[model samples]
Target: MTTETTETTGTEAADIQAIKEIVATVQRTQRAKDPEGFLALFHPDALWTTGHGKVLIGLDAIAEFTRAVLPAANWEGEVTYEPVHIQFLRPDVAAVKVRQVYRSAEEESEGAPLYVMTKRGDGKWLLHACQNTQVQAG
Candidate 1:
């Protein structure tokens, strides 16, 4: 393979790993109920639609909802968020599909969230828009 091809391949792998880390961080924040840390990953004009159909516009609204719910969430086992897929719409924009599993000793539930992320000029990836959908059990 050419040197340029190798470099591009390396970069793509790195980008995928970085995005995976971001998704994992999402789970960590949720499991720890760290609303502030979670909110830090969002863009200022980000929009989020919850699994239950609540539409939250902007970071402030998301912060409000997150701060209220995350800390008060009463779940037994830790939540898990996995990056199932990633698609780049542009060099600086991507759509990530994530699987969120909430596990407890006696109960388990799941959510499928689509995260649209944007890479800023500063090279930081921030969530631009997202939809959290409930995954029904069979």
Candidate 2:
């Protein structure tokens, strides 16, 4: 029982760590336009959906989408986030909700954005979906 408990605990810890790494990778990849770097974290059959309602299924489509979006935009600011929740659907999957704050390139200032991320896969957490909504300045 003790050994089994230890093993379960270890697996849970590793799963959580993997999920966090996926979140960090998604963040880094979006900010830097790192397509290959970002795709490395995904599974072969993964799916990606952007806030704009664009859907990219599979690695090929994902790469194409990344190339078109990331490099084309002249983003010049930092991206920050406030943790809302991380719900584990399974040891290998999770749903993450957060309030993202991106520095506004339009005004060269800061803005709040809410984002939802879903994780998938067994060994590593791959971003299954993400939705971003802009926050209006009050």
Candidate 3:
């Protein structure tokens, strides 16, 4: 489901911190190749989009996808959140823009630009939806 970010002036520091934590958690899990851990940070009804209509709905699908993608080879990378931009939709929801660069065990580093929207659940922020694209250098 698509959501329009609410127009508001002052955003809360706690909410911004929460969003940052979730983004960091996702990157950590990817580096660890921990599917269950990665899936735990997402909402039960999350929509994970990996470009070109590749969408995984629900936590189970996301878990499967993570396991399939992350374990093929030993992988490690550093993801830097360059100028992360957070937009508050409500007190309990936010959208964040992040820039990530990843390097696998055998591949060169590549950058990707992403937008991830998260909802606060039971005092924690859980990713709800995401849109991303690879940053290609010409």
Q: Pick the candidate with the highest lDDT.
A: 1
Question: Per-model C-alpha lDDT, please?
Answer: 0.84, 0.60, 0.67
Q: For model 1, what is the alpha-carbon lDDT of residue 10?
A: 64
| Candidate 2: residue 58 Cα off by (Å) | 2.1
The model with the greatest TM-score is 1
* Tens digits of lDDT, candidate 3, 36-97: 88788878888887744578888888788878986673555555444257776667766677
TM-score of each: 0.90, 0.69, 0.76
Worst 10-residue lDDT window for candidate 2 reads 1-10
For residues 51-129, what per-residue lDDT tens digits would candidate 2 score against the true structure? 5667778778878887777777777777755445566655555666655666764663333322233344336456665
lDDT of 1 by residue, 105-136 (tens): 89889898999998888877888999999999
Which whole-number lDDT from 0 to 100 does residue 87 have in model 2? 61
- Ten contiguous residues minimizing lDDT sum, candidate 1: 1-10
Positional deviation of residue 84's Cα in model 3 after best superposition, in angstroms = 1.2
Between candidates 1 and 3, name the one with more favorable lDDT: 1
